[model samples]
Target: MMHSLAVRVYYEDTDLAGIVYYANYLKFIERGRSEWLRDLGIDQAAMKENSGHVFAVRRIEADYLRPARFDDLLSVETALVQATAARIVLDQTVRRDDAALFAARVTLACLDGSGRPVRLPKGLAEALAAG
Candidate 1:
């Protein structure tokens, strides 16, 4: 399943050139992933509180293709690429209209409160698989 979130580039999101700063694309995609999990009925806060488990980015391979200027309406699209006991892989893209501005493959690891790797919650794993 694919999930998309809308983002508007504000002045703060841009650099002196009035174009979105490269790092902000990561923020956009992060929101996309969070919303995607929410849509799948995964409550991150509850999971962390109840199970002491949280997700952290383990790796990211990103490509910046085009520039997004201030005030541009952008869409961040996220899709699950794979899910495992301890990790999930996602493909995400930032687009303006139909044009892809940035793309990334992100790997996220489930971690315990102690910051040690842990298996994903059963419900979350199942939800991701079903989706």
Candidate 2:
């Protein structure tokens, strides 16, 4: 099963045309990824204090299937597409219930303070594999 979260479009999330701005799609996908990790008991705050490591988006490819209008309650679904020693790929989608409005694949690399590549916490890596 995929990790899911609901995002209600507010005026701040939209453009002058009252549609979700193209770039904010990334934020929705970020939320999905955050919750995905949270579900597996990965505490982002604790990670930083203990490991000095954080996950950073290394790549993203998006497809705008349709427009999501203001006030639309959208579901952001995220699944682990791949996970390796130092990175994870997530298949993220925004849907209005059953209708997909946007989709993307996001690759995030685990990094140290200087942005050098680092392995994900061993437990989190195993968690992704289990999923």
Computed on alpha carbons, the lDDT of every model, listed in order, comes to 0.96, 0.91
**Candidate 2: misplaced stretches above 4 Å?**
none
Runs of candidate 1 exceeding 4 Å displacement:
none
In the order shown, the candidates' Cα RMSDs to the true structure are 0.5, 1.0
lDDT by residue (tens digit), candidate 1, 66-85: 99999999999999999999
Estimate the overall C-alpha local distance difference test score of candidate 2: 0.91
Which pairs of residues clash in candidate 1, taking residues 3 or more apart in a chain or in different chains?
Answer: none
Clashing pairs in 2: none
Residues 22-125, candidate 2: write the lDDT tens digits. 98998898888898899998999899889888999999999999999989999999988888899999899999989999999999999988889999998898
Give the candidate number with the greatest lDDT. 1
